[model samples]
Target: MDYNLMREFADSWGLLAMALFFVGCVAFALRPGGRRQADEAARIPLKDD
Candidate 1:
């Protein structure tokens, strides 16, 4: 495999993929019911069985 070809692919497509992934993660975190899930998770460590 040629280094230059791989570098070009990463510079273009890899960057786009990472950007899309970041946006997806942000959207998921902000989706409906996310706050409730986050609140429940926050109490886990303090809860006693």
Candidate 2:
């Protein structure tokens, strides 16, 4: 296995940004407000085609 490359990849800013984004998404999904908003949006009908 390429330990050096893997280490570099994991340590890069892009990976950190993605990880933070993933965590934020998970947190948002688990929030009551988020769930409620999603549910309400799903039930809403579009006014126009």
Candidate 3:
């Protein structure tokens, strides 16, 4: 509950958690077969209902 403890947790675990999340997102975006889904999503706004 103290500032020092919170700061240390943020500097260590928080950084690790954020890094892992970013890497997971990058992996998902770059994975095989994702291009087709991405292209479809990109054209959603231009599609008529």
TM-score of each: 0.94, 0.57, 0.96
Instruction: Show model 3 residue runs off by greater than 4 Å.
Output: none
The alpha-carbon deviation from the true structure for residue 20 of candidate 2, after best TM-score superposition, in angstroms, is 0.5
| Candidate ranking (TM-score, best to worst) | 3, 1, 2
Q: Give Cα-based local distance difference scores for all models.
A: 0.99, 0.84, 1.00
lDDT of 3 by residue, 1-49 (tens): 9999999999999999999999999999999999999999999999999
Q: What is the lDDT of candidate 2?
A: 0.84
lDDT of each residue in 1-49, candidate 2, tens digit only: 6998878877897688899999999998998788789977887795354
Off by over 4 Å in 2: 1-11, 46-49
lDDT of 1 by residue, 1-49 (tens): 9999999999999999999999999999999999999999999999999
Best by TM-score: 3
What is the RMSD, in Å, between candidate 2 and the native fold over all Cα?
A: 4.9
Sorted by lDDT (best first), the order is: 3, 1, 2
TM-score of model 2 (CA atoms):
0.57
Q: What does the lDDT come to for candidate 3? A: 1.00
